[model samples]
Target: MAPRNKEQEAEVLSWIFEVLGEKVPSGQYEDILKDGIVLCKLINKIAPGSVKKIQERGTNFQLMENVQRFQAAIKKYGVPEEEIFQTADLFERRNIPQVTLCLYCLGRITQKHPEYTGPGLGPKMADKNERTFTEEQLRAHEGELNLQMGFNKGASQSGHGGFGNSRHM
Candidate 1:
């Protein structure tokens, strides 16, 4: 095996020390030792603050310590992991700022989600107004109205109202 470079060793030591500092209580030597054992278990390497490497190889003492710590923390505190994560996620969801829309895709002013913009009949078309008219009745009514309005006489360049040719355009 190649000898460890000074810079790489320093970086790894710094990381281990940082993790130890976070995990261990200040002025507690035994807790510091436990942290070192956990770190050694983590990397399968030399324990920090020890003259010798720990001999218990392949055992997950680091993960075991973490589990013990987690259990202790939950016992001491009233909060669970699900509670914490759900609270954080709900905060992020509710904190999203509302935006104003300028011109809609249908060339009208409307509110919409940020990403989508296209020609649509919009929500008014989706609402059931309880007005019942069969297709045949609607067609006959429309044809009568068009004939009465002299739409077929070629007098008016604009056609009688229905769906119109805007969909084709």
Candidate 2:
């Protein structure tokens, strides 16, 4: 590939750092990088719009299903909700790249510690038959959200919020 200009390079590096903080400790860069790629792929499957969103945001951070899911999981699992909440916050704020990373972490936790089932067993328990979040499906969701958000933005920007001017109250 051709070498990126300074601006382009800076942007990429900035995104990397934004998603992976310095305090993440040393010796984990490889795993983090690997996980990031896997997650990007998974999320591309689950919600390609999230991928476009990360791109649109001009950052590498990954957006997942949403924090509410995790919050619910914490309640169900009876684990320390604070930890999950904080993690979800990081992903929501795009401080981390990809929300699936958090889910992966949670999945591992549940596996390693049976006591930690997370907040919502329903979603987790949904059999393999229902868990087909392919990249194509995600692309559809992205398209829908994009259209909705675009319409909202346009409508709002149009001044009267989609409705024409109103006479008397």
lDDT of each: 0.32, 0.37
Per residue, candidate 2 scores C-alpha lDDT tens digits across 24-104 of: 333433334332343343333332333332221223333233233334443454334443434333443433333333443
lDDT of 2 at 60: 34
Total colliding residue pairs, candidate 1? 0
**Best candidate per lDDT, number?**
2
Candidate 1: tens digits of C-alpha lDDT, residues 37-101: 44343222211222234433344554344324422333233323332222111122321111001
Clashing residue pair totals per candidate (backbone < 3 A) = 0, 12
TM-score of each: 0.17, 0.22
